[model samples]
Target: MLLKAKYKKNIFFFFKSLLISMQNFLKQFKPKKYKAYNKYVIVSAVYNVEKYLDDFFKSIINQRLDFKSNIYLICVDDGSTDNSANIIKKYQKKYPKNITYLYKENGGQASSRNLGLKYLKENDLNIFWVTFTDPDDFLDRDYFYEVDSFLKKQNNIAMVATNIIFY
Candidate 1:
């Protein structure tokens, strides 16, 4: 009887430790949640854009903006034949809190944009503003700052457009 009791305790402890370790291992796979500020969603459609991705990423990440606003970048990979998806993934990993990368079948730019919009709606991000950009295009460093300032001062505007300068 003493031997049986000791075996049962050992089995129970073994299972308990196994369960604890399993939970700990699963915790590493859990997705992280980020706090949203004056949440702004920047959506982009990427298709075979590997060559331009680095500059696009650098431009977005380098934005000089107030901390009161948070930028959430959502890029839809519309069946990129090249390394565009991998490039986006690199940025996503680097800025996990600010980037959401999506993959979809070969769709045109509009379809990719629609998918991104749907994702924003489904996630219910409570977004305050939205902006779009092409993978080859870059924005000014103070783009978001100026946009945020303008929107704060204006009450009736639904959309604002900035002058685009092509070089």
Candidate 2:
């Protein structure tokens, strides 16, 4: 019993230390205020989304943010099992370094977003703004700029949203 208790304590301490180390590693990557551009948008794309791929990518590529201030667009290909990957590939070719990709196994939408978030967190990308865009929807150019600009200028705001229509 005495030996077992000591072993258990050692195990507990080991795990505790491991957890702290992981936290520290993540913290190191935490985003700092960009002297030039401190904001980012995490746009995600995944499998079986050919229907909405073109409009979606186009919308992002055409964002009107102050390009002088970098808007890091972190995009992902979540193990798409369709021409979805091909379409995303096209975007990759067209945009070059504009889009960042995190290709993962065949996980669902939530997984895709989670993977994207992991990349964001690991890279310490200070994203003062993020908005979800449905792969199957069309967006106006002003969507993100309006949200980001409005949020940036406001000193006392909590939440912002738009009308949603689901057929």
Top candidate (TM-score) = 1
For model 1, which pairs clash?
A: none
For model 1 the TM-score comes to 0.74
lDDT (Cα atoms) of all candidates against the true structure: 0.82, 0.66
For residues 21-125, write the lDDT of model 2, one tens digit per residue: 899999988534222223656567566788888888776656665432555556577777778777776777766655676687877788888877777778776
Task: Tell me the number of clashing residue pairs for each predicted model.
Answer: 0, 1
Model 1's alpha-carbon lDDT is 0.82
Candidate 1 lDDT, 24-132, residue by residue in tens: 9999986443333245788899999899999998887777763224788999999989999899999899888788999999979999999999999999888868888
